[model samples]
Target chain A: MLEWIRFIFTAAFLAAGIFILIASVRGVYKFDYALNRMHAAAMGDTLGIFFVLIGLVFSAPDIWLGAKLVLIIVFLWIASPVGSHLIARLEVNTNPIWEKDVTAARRTIEEGDTHGHL
Target chain B: MSKRNSNWGNTLQGRFLRWMRFGWEPMDVLLIDKMSQDRDESVNDALSAAENLRDLQLSEKYNADTAIEHSIMQELDEWSLSKGRKIVNRLYALLSVTLCVTVILLLLETVIAMPMRGVAVSPTNNEVSQRYIEEGMEETGAVNIVAGMILDYRAFDTLGESTVLFIAACAVLILLRIDRDKDGRPTQELIAAEEDDRSHEPKSDRILQGSAMILTPVVLLFGIYVVLNGHLSPGGGFSGGAIIGAGLILYLNAFGFAKASRFFSYKTFALITLLSLSFYALAKAYSFYCGANGLPSGIPLGTPGSILSSGLILPLNICVGMVVACTMYIFYAMFRKGGI
Candidate 1:
């Protein structure tokens, strides 16, 4: 019963992770702007990775292996956000017509708008 | 307008032609807006943005105006005679494809030539390999046979590989390293303040800096552990050093080069790499001498599986780890900016 439960959990998490990864890739292609593409990529970097690692931990043969997988997840969780933030900042700074592509949320903040396109 | 069309025509090829034909340059929006303002101003704006006519005339850096005209004429000549160039490019592409196919075929042929299949007693499973498996622990005093072979039996080859890495770093320094004066002093340009480029930085994201500060020590500690315990387990100097190097890179990225370079400058990189490489060479040379002479080096191999058991392997691993870590960090630093 315990083994069956573990199998089910692992399978569910793995499937969810794969689904998220496929969605992220599709979103990357569908998005028009670099920032929008980055948003999609960042989801894969965080949540897709999180679910896959969780599934691996569930299926891990030993406690030490599970712990190592958890450590990897922790490290990625810290690193991925910083990487995404840097890439987004680069895109914002370099793209001259960046202001023209502003969404409704960003367009409301007039003060925040000036610093971006210039 | 003729000049712009000529410029585009010179480099016309398959994909670029298709893209240009589809009107990919979104500068049309800006151009249309300029045209609406004034008919005459549209050409001027397009000329400035597309080709910078004024900047070209002011700078004699390319030589006299006639020389610039000469180059423009040469480009036009190439554009007019595009057919021959196109054929040459196609021939070059064909040659490249043929070369790639030949290489792949050779590699596959070699792979197919090998006949060893499944649990069959191949020549590799002979006395030489069996001897190493049986006596690896006793002779090398390392529980891990792979570690014993790499650090003891084939230590010389590993030494050579480490030297190769060191030489590669030197080569990169020669090619890409900039603004260093005689006696290897960093020029004022390299050592100058980052105040001018301050606007480019993301202004020390607190989350990144804080997490880096917390994680760096733990990562470094883990790297050290892996390097030291190489003989006992699977982890080794190369991997451990990479981990430590990554930790340092993360710290550098978060804090910026100004803070990071205070501790790890070009001088520090030079000192650590030189000391580690020299020590590695000397130690390996001594080990080789003893082995060739068939005399015991008097360095006792400690009991198997203990941290101290593998006499020279532990110290050698440390040397390699230091070199690898320094190399990794230096590569990052040099590539990111010319300095440090």
Candidate 2:
């Protein structure tokens, strides 16, 4: 019974991960802008990897392998956001047509919007 | 001549096939009937058409002041020619990229869903796996069975893969490398390329540079470790080499081509790739010859699990790593700026 439960959990998680990844690809196909596609890509890079690896950890042959999977998740979570930031910066820099959509501000206070709490 | 040949178009079999294909062929039946009736007339029509073309060409040549026949190729102006080529290239790139991405996604899905490590009853764990697992350590003298299998057992295949990468790099070089004058000065095109980079590429972005400064050395060190420990770990030459190449790319992005060229240039890439490939070829050849002719591979297979245990696998791994690294870095350099 316990093994069956674990198997079900693993399957569910794996399915969810695959679904999210497919959704990410679909989003890329559907979205017009590069930045929007990158947003989808970043989701796949972070959350999809996280869910899949976590599922694999449940069925991992050994503790060391599970730990390694977790490490992979950690590394991706750290790096993916940074990578997305760099790619977005590149997109903004190279393509000047996005200027109208973008509003530049040096400080948070200068934007005249104060709704969020730290 | 027309009477000598049978009217094969209106034959029973042809009629049957045409009927089957079109279902109700009012047009085809009428056409075939007309064709069978007017065979000589059709030939005469074709000859007359040729004469008309010739007459048209003669008139164009004699009467027109312009050498170019605008009527035939009026659409292909200088601007349209270049623009059409660009559009075609872009379309080709888009199609290929989408195809590659779809294939990769499907393959990834398959691999991730499949059970990887252990199984009592499975197709993945066949005789091949058993052979590799049981006798791999004894024959190849490497802890990592995959590394042993790829490098020692199937060295020729890896050699071919390396050669493919080298050829690709060479092709890119031939296509994109900037030509220089006799005195080794930058040509006009090269100067234009320099100005292009100056205008577009990142000009010392602090965040990227700072992160790269902290990360590049560690990434390089990890790549070296992966390459050296190929026989003992999951990673081998190819993956390690790619990692090293990524690190080099990061370094190049952080500090421009000039900084990268201090240690690695076109000369460095050419030399490393040449020496490594030659060494790999010679070693593989020696192994193949000895194995084929029933002579012992004289090189001592040291104790397994140790880095130095695999006789030629380590050196072979290093050679592959060098070639792959050079090829990857040069590919990027050539694509970014025609020369390294």
Candidate 3:
């Protein structure tokens, strides 16, 4: 009974991770802007990976293996954010027409105010 | 006399007919002129009718010829499109069938040649392997038979493999290395282009730089540990060197070549690779000579489990590790810039 319960939990976690990763991939294709695609990819990199690794740890045969799995999570957590930040910076630097694709903060507020006034 | 008169009468009759037909009187002359004019007109009319019939025939024949030519051209076009497509499809199908047959035959040959698993007569139970299993540890002085085999028993092959990698790196360097002036300054145009490229690329993010700085030392330490402990553990020079090389690359990406060059320059890469490879060659040559001459190499095989043990294996692994790490870094540098 306990084994079956553990199996179910692991499967559920893995499935959820897979679903999130798939959704992120879809979002990447659906989003028009590079920044929005990056946002979707970062979610998969962090949350999807986390869930999958957590599930793997539960199914690991030994303590050392489980510890290594957790270490991978920690390393990715540190690495992915940095990677995402660099990519975002790259997108900002390289894209000359980024302003047209994404609205500026000041313009967004003014537009909202105009709408309210109307 | 009467006969003569009769002959004269016949002559007169002929004469009279001639007078009537060729009479040159005024009325007779007018009648001849009218008759000649009518005859000329009738002849002209007949000639014109024949000419018109010839023209109609020529036009009908031309129309039939053009229609036949057009139909033939359309048929040729249809043949080229549909018939040509069918021919191409047939050629491709034949090629695929040939390839599939050849592949299947090759696979079947391999399967037939393979020894049955678990049979005593299998290749795995051969005398050479039996000896290796029984005496490899003692002969090589390493607990890990796999490492001992690679570093000692088959060290020449490993050396060759390493040299292949070195040559590959050299080839890439030759093809892609940036040309510098006598003063070691990169060419002005190349520098200008690089500057333009860098302007478009993002500068290092603070978070990325910070994380890389923190992780760099740890990663390097781990790589060293793996390299040093290769003989006694699961990890070896290849994996360890790859890790260290990756860490170095990550640092370079975060901080850029200017910062990374302080520690690892093109000169440094060249020197390390040259020294390590030379040392490895000399060491292996000495061991091979000793082994061939049935003489001990005089290098002590210290206690197997200790870091300093395994005679030449530890040093060899470190040399391999250095070569690998430098090669990886040089490869990355060459890809990024034309040179390190």
Which residue pairs show collisions in model 1?
Answer: none
> In order, how many clashes per candidate?
0, 0, 0
Q: Which candidate tops lDDT?
A: 2
RMSD of each: 18.5, 15.8, 24.9
Please give me the DockQ of candidate 3 compared with the native complex: 0.32
Shift in Å, residue B334, candidate 1? 1.7
- TM-score for candidate 2 (chain B): 0.65
| Model 2, span B1-340: residue lDDT tens | 5463276656777667778887947567978778867778878789899999999998887767454566546667665687988988999999999999999999999989888667766678889878889988988889999898899878889999999999999999999999897899989999998888876666566667867787788789889999999999899899899999999998998789889899998788889999999999999898888854436889888998877888899999999998888888988988988876
Model 2 regions lying over 4 Å from their true place:
A1-31, A99-118, B1-61, B64-136, B143-146, B285-294
Off by over 4 Å in 1: A98-118, B1-82, B85-93, B119-121, B180-199, B291-294
Question: Which residue pairs of candidate 2 clash?
Answer: none
Tell me the deviation in Å of residue B229 in model 1.
Answer: 1.9
DockQ, each predicted model = 0.17, 0.08, 0.32
Instruction: Using TM-score as the measure, name the better of candidate 2 and candidate 3.
Output: 3
Model-by-model lDDT, in order? 0.80, 0.84, 0.82
- In what order do the candidates fall by TM-score, top score first? 1, 3, 2
Query: Could you give the interface RMSD of candidate 3 in angstroms?
Result: 8.6
The residue-by-residue lDDT of candidate 3 on B1-340, one tens digit each, is 3445555423656556656777745455457667767787778889789999999999999999999999999998898799977998999999999999999999999999999887999988899988777887677777777778889888898889788878988998998776878888879856965786476444445677789888888789889998888888876777788888999988888788778889998789879889989999999999998864447889888877888888888888888888889889889878776755
Q: Per-residue lDDT of A1-118 in model 2, one digit per residue for the tens?
A: 9788878888988998999999998998999999999999899888888889889988887899999898777667756776887888779766878654433422332565433110
TM-score of the second chain, each candidate in turn, equals 0.68, 0.65, 0.70
